[model samples]
Target: MKAIVVVGASLAGLRGAEALRQQGFDGTLTMIGAEPHLPYDRPPLSKEVLRGTWEPEQASLVRGDNIDKLELDLRLGRRATSLDTGRRRVELDDGSAVSYDGLLIATGATPRRLPGTDGMEGVHTLRTLDDCLAIRAGLERGPRVAVVGAGFIGAEVAATCRQRGLDVTMIEMLPVPLEPAVGADVGEALAAVHRDEGVDLRLGVGVDAIEGDGRVEAVRLSDGSRVEADLVVVGVGVAPETGWLEGSGVKVDDGVACDARCATSVPGVVAAGDVASWHNRTFDETMRVEHWSNAAEQARAATSTLLAGDGGGDPFESVPFFWSDQYDLKIQSAGRLAGADASRIVSGSLETRRFLKLYGRGGRLVGALAVNEPRRLMVMRRQIRALPDFDEAVAAASDDGSA
Candidate 1:
């Protein structure tokens, strides 16, 4: 390939570009990004950056000198408006077209917003650096913060707000936060941690609307209750940013549909990160992971597939892993936990807020969740790669001396 074009200019995009260079692809590499700033770490936007523990620059993914070494034809503040698969060209919002011998789509995702909340002051979504700064600025007012969605982002934001001595109210439509991912038992234990730290967690309730004359004054719940707040952070979830690929003939089911090797429907094109919904040979399932780890790992896999000519590369069968920090707790999980049918607490106890739980599906170990027990979690993570029998894995966990 003579030239390669990478969209997104995000963590995945940056990683993909680096992989292309490391894999000996000394081609004309063009990276087009909608944001003006270079790629930076996003995981800190909700924790270190929002909590004022780390400055914005501290979250940068690469140094200026190192990025210069990549020799990227970096086009910042330029959005890819559309793709033409036939001509292998990408049309930018600036009305310019860039043709490529290979393409990597790592556009990632956009956080979902509440209805009628757009243009409203004090209503924010934590996705970009500017979004984090805006929310941080609002935090200085010591406002009563209402965090919608009890997911990782919402939980982290609430925890950070409470640490700053601010009144925080977190609302979730489900009865327990993260129930779908880690099961109800584990999710409730996590919920207890938030309550212990004085977070007003309103579960099994949906946001009716954001009530205010102009600025966000309160959030009305579906159960006829109101959480009065000066600021609101919507973290309901995110949708993959695939609108630009609508008529490109590249399949998009939840994200850019790809094979196990990260090869998309269109030849010479591949996708990674939150924007790619690919088959995982490990779990024999199709998934799109939005976690920080998956973004970096999948980018390299996607790049390998792009260089290997579609089906020539090895399958990207990775065991997904993610971590989140909330208050005094450090939560980590590996493998697929969404469709788990059985789960068992293998180490520690939920009452103590420290444990390693194993999730199983179809009598095989499929996932693991750890709260404070990093060592045991990694052991389970390795065991999960072989898809051990559920009961035997549980039995092994009991005999493991390291755990």
Candidate 2:
């Protein structure tokens, strides 16, 4: 039987394997992962898992029985050190090689660790299950938590700490949470939510250093203020986990460059999830999204293209979609708005903390961000697929207009 090898036991990897099986490929499947744990849902790690609402083990997406039934050669705790595209083989860190008829590069990313704080006892990041366990344990002890980034991860961590009754403070170099992703207006709305929840939200403040001898005791800011905390969770962001493929001939820009079908430059090699960067249809540009839905959608598209056999479509086309639950609000965004030349407020009053913002470039609808209104996002999706005029839609979104 032909062997199809998937690297990185992340969301995309697991979903891709399932899609391949669903496509009726009865080949030998091997999954390689650096972490020893089974594939788990990461979006919950920073949210429910840290809040004590979910167990750490409950975060896993795939179970042992499922893998056994699939008859997948599960290689847990094995890291792919390098890839030999010419030979169609993957080199494992254990000095072993796995030959493959087809390969999928779903090796996700690692949290960018803070420098000089690696060996420190109390510094943490919430990328993997182990990291969540460590942070959850620290929260159980009611340690003061200082989060170094105000992005989604940082905000969720702060909210989780507050839910556990631990003193929490969030620090960000920007003036608001998710300023770059959603723009200043929407970001400030999120910051207000954090403040109303009793979080010490610090904006435009840089971390001078993490202060402590052997353990974290305080976080010093660039403005000379210090927040005392026994625990620190750094959510600065993540870089693509492409170190293993450094000399592997797979093109890596911001991430592994893939065509619309998620195929890499090397034949028979594909990439998906946060590790893969491809042309975004709505934005008409290349992007690498780290959201959970993106991983699943990309994997499904990649799998279909793979099974179709030879000279498939140019690329996968899916508008970006991601959601976050914090302080009773369900925030959702569809399509990419970074290149928006203009935007207008739509539906619900912005001052009331419930609204949808429409973005467009050259008068064409590009994206929409909604706060506490998920139904509107669903409508935005259909309108986005048609590439409607942003000006009319922005005016109509408030009038209960159809997508």
Candidate 3:
């Protein structure tokens, strides 16, 4: 390929471009980004940036010398309006078009906004640097913060707020935090950590509305109880940014549908990271993960596939992994947790709020979580990655520390 265009210019886009170059692709590299700034890390926005321990600029993914080495054309602050697969061109909002020999879509995702909260001051969602900065400014006022999701982002925001000495309330429709991902047992165990840190966690309840006259004053729950707050941080996950791909024949369902090799439905095109809903050949399932690590891994795989041409590269297969820090606790998990038929605390007891939990489905080990127990969790995570028998995984996880 003489020309390669990567849309989105976020972590996945940056990593894919770098990997293309690293994998010996001497093509004309071009990147298109809607954001004006270079690709920066998003994980720290809710924690370090909100706590003022780190500056927003410090979250940049690119280093001083790293960006120049890629030698790619950057179309920053340009929104892609549509894609022309036949002509191999991308139509931008500015009425310009960029044609390419190969294309990689890494448009990433945007935080889902709560209904009736749009354009309201003091209500925020953290997705980008600007979003974090706005939330940080909201925190500076020392107001009571009400977070409207119990997922990683919401929990992190609540933790950061509590650590900052702000009265924070975390609301989740699920019965426990991360219940959708980690299951109720592990999620309940972790919720205790937040409660111990002085966070008011409200679970199994829906938000009726975000109430405010001009700015956010309070949030009403489905039970008719109102949480009076000055700041409302909504961390209700994110949706893939794939609206422009409609009618583009790219096959987007929640995200751009890709094969096991990360190749899209449209030939000569592929997708990675948050924008990719790829069928993982390793796990024998289709998944769309929004974690930071998945983006880099999938991007590298897509890059290699790009360089190898059609039907030439290995499929993308990596264990899904992510971590979250809440106060003094470091929570980490790997593999699939939702579809597990059974699970149990393998190493440590949940009474101590520290354990390694293993999950299994249909006799196969599927997932694992470590709560302030890193070493053993690493081993258990490896077991999950290996797709061992449930009985064998249990035996390995119950092994003594010497193992």
lDDT of 3 by residue, 1-403 (tens): 9999999999999999999998888879999999899999988988898899998789999889898999989999999999999999999999999998889999999888988888999999888888889888878889999999988888899999998999999999988777767888778877887888898989989999999998999999998899999999888889999999988999988799998999998878989999899989768999999888999999999878877788767889878888888887788888888888888777877777688888898999988888898877676767677788987778766746334
Taking the tens digit of each residue's C-alpha lDDT, what string does model 1 give over 111-197? 999999999999999999999999999999899999999999999999999999999999999998999989999999999999999
Candidate 3: which pairs clash?
Answer: none
Top-lDDT structure, candidate number: 1
lDDT of each: 0.93, 0.86, 0.88
- The order by descending TM-score is 1, 3, 2
**Segments in model 1 whose C-alpha atoms lie over 4 Å from true places:** 399-403
Query: Candidate 3 clash total?
Result: 0
Native-to-model Cα distance after best TM-score fit, residue 35 in candidate 3, in Å? 0.8
Error of 2 at 261 (Å): 1.6
lDDT of 2 by residue, 52-127 (tens): 7888778878676776666789899999999998898999999999999888889888899888998899999889
Residue 65 shift from truth in candidate 1, angstroms = 1.7
lDDT score, residue 250, model 1? 97
Q: What is the lDDT of residue 107 in candidate 1?
A: 98
